[model samples]
Target: MRKRLSAQIAARRKQQVPADLKGMDASLMAMLDAQIGDLEQRIKGVIEQEAASAAKARLLLSIPGIGPVSAAMLIAEMPELGRMTSGEAAAMTGLAPIPHDSGAMRGKRAIAGGRRALRHVLFQAALAAASHNPVLKPVAQALKIHGKPHKLVIVAIARRLVTIANAILKTGIPWQPQPDS
Candidate 1:
């Protein structure tokens, strides 16, 4: 029992530090800080690469939430959006739930296809849109009413956002989220 008690004490000591800053030694912290700086520079490079890829994507920056990298990833990955209908584009990104029907029975809504990375970037944009754009927050709130999972509702909005973004890119016009009327 004493041995177990000592082990527990040592474990608690380790857990006292926050996970993000668990280690000792100033030199280790310095090295981590330098690496973080380098990573920031690399992220900057990726953002620039995205900006240079398409003027349409660059226009996405006009929207509050989308940055160069997110816009670029959307543009590069969602090429069909430029050619397909808004709904089709959204479905392709796996934002729309696949309807499963049966005789007098129905399963819950589920997002199929692991276009998860695209979904994540778009969701970020949606979050920004909901917070800043006068139009989207109400829509998000309305969607929240059905007792749907918060993430699914966000995913739905994110899909709608991509549809809106597609039009902006194709028409060479600035994005304007639909005003809540």
Candidate 2:
């Protein structure tokens, strides 16, 4: 909605319009920005509150790619994080690849059927990890080097992120990037 409004404002500016009308659009954009800011602050406050209640959230945030939003989402949406296996965690997030095969025929493995919102948030976090997290960056690079498609690489990273999150939660340890051995 914010993006759409910004685009509309830009478009309006490009067109020949009355000054008053342009000003109205600018005013609306400012209002939208303020609303967005307010919502972000509220989200931050809620996340902070939740983190206080669940120490696991603080542990989750210690991961490079996992921010307050991702930590809060995981704590709220996936209460089974610490108790689940890595594969189970990935499956829960819809990052696990599903196998498809028949006698004398092998079909492609694809990911499906899990928490969609959690999957989306994991993907976003994966993208950040791929670029910014030292420990996970090589995983993304290796997948790309092996000719994996962009989305496939992202899903793989998301799966890894879920596994890492699970491990940290289970162990009650903050993330410490280890050198590849």
Return the top candidate by lDDT.
2
For each candidate in turn, the TM-score is: 0.68, 0.81
lDDT of 2 by residue, 1-181 (tens): 4336556657766777676787777787688778766765776677667644358877898998987768767987898999989999988888889989999899999999989988988888999999999988998999999999999999998998889999999999889989678
Q: Each model's C-alpha lDDT? A: 0.68, 0.84
TM-score of model 1 vs. true structure: 0.68
RMSD of each: 8.8, 3.8
Give RMSD (Å) of candidate 1 vs. truth: 8.8
- What residue pairs clash in candidate 2, if any at all? none
How far out, in Å, is residue 167 in model 1?
1.4
Task: State the local distance difference test value for candidate 1.
Answer: 0.68
lDDT for position 71 in model 2: 78
Error of 1 at 117 (Å): 1.3
lDDT of 1 by residue, 1-181 (tens): 2224444545655565665665563445455556655654665566567644446656677766677556766766776566678877788778877878788888777777746678777877888776775666677788787676788768877877777777777777786656445
Candidate 2 wrongly placed segments (more than 4 Å)? 1-22, 50-54
Q: Distance from true position, residue 110, model 2, in Å?
A: 0.3
